[model samples]
Target: MIEELQDVPAGVVGTRVSGRVTADDFRDFKPAMDRMLDAGEVRIIEVIGPDYEGFGPGGLLADVKQGFSTLTHMRAFKRTAVVTDKEWIGHTLHALAWMIPGEVALFGMDELDAAKQWAAG
Candidate 1:
């Protein structure tokens, strides 16, 4: 599941992902992101909880579709902060950051506050 995080700085979108992420979750998530992007360039903070069980098949497809749709607007993002304790998730984000137009940082779950601060900047 995915739920929006409140009380973030302006122009920043925050979300927490846990349990099994489904297409339904993305359906709920995309609008919030679009709203942020529509306003102007934005930063993102994603917190992956220990209960996160990865994405469902439909969620994967939704993610791919979102990726293609946002490919041209990648520069609209200023920063992305991923908070996760999983080493593999951190490595994956690090590798993917090379292709992203903005700065992407990975922080341990314990550093969620730091991640939020960096993303809000």
Candidate 2:
């Protein structure tokens, strides 16, 4: 399941994810993202819990497609911060950080407040 991480600033959007995320997760999130984009708020910060069991195959595909399909829209973001307590996830973010056009950072859940601070700045 997923829910918006409220209390963030107007320019930033945040979410938390847990369990086996399905295409429904993407479908549910797309409109939020689209609305944010339309509103000229591009930054995003996602807190992914360790309980996240990974995405369904189709969900994974949809995520990849969205990256490409919304490449321009996605690139409008100045940064994407992924906060997690999982080491491997942090490592993955570190690995891809340079590849993504915008800055990407990973922080442990223990440092989530710091992460949000950085993302919001």
Candidate 3:
């Protein structure tokens, strides 16, 4: 699930994705993400740690829908730092980084602080 994280740097929206992410997770988390998007600029820190079990089908669909529906909002993405130990996630994000309008970086789970610093920058 996408559980919000606190104590992050200013202007950074931090979240942790763990366990089986279901539709309910997004239902509860979308508002914060929407608010970030509405602000017209986004510096996001996504920490997908060892506990992450991938997203449920519904959650995946919701994510895809939200992303595709706001293609223009890609420009609002200032920086995205993904902190994870998952190899697949790192590969996927690396492959898709070019599609994002801003910097997209991958960090080891232990480097969350560094990720936050990069995102906030």
User: What are the runs in model 3 whose C-alpha is more than 4 Å off?
Assistant: none
Residue ranges of candidate 1 with Cα displaced over 4 Å: none
In model 1, state the lDDT of residue 92: 82
Per-residue C-alpha lDDT of model 2 across residues 1-121, encoded as one tens digit per residue: 6778887766888999998877788888888878777865477788899899888757888778767766767557787888888888877877777767567877778887777778778
lDDT (CA) per prediction: 0.84, 0.79, 0.88
Residues 1-121, model 1: lDDT tens digits: 8899996777788898998888888888888878977877979888898888898859889877877878768778899988998788878877788876688888888898888889988
| Clashes per candidate (backbone, < 3 Å) | 0, 0, 0
* Top TM-score hit: 3
Q: Candidate 2: how many backbone clashes?
A: 0
Report residue 70 deviation for candidate 2 (angstroms): 1.7
Model 2, residue 49: distance off in Å is: 0.7
Q: List where candidate 2 sits over 4 angstroms from the true fold.
A: none
Q: Roughly what TM-score does model 3 have, to 2 decimal places? A: 0.93
Could you tell which candidate, 2 or 3, scores higher by TM-score?
3
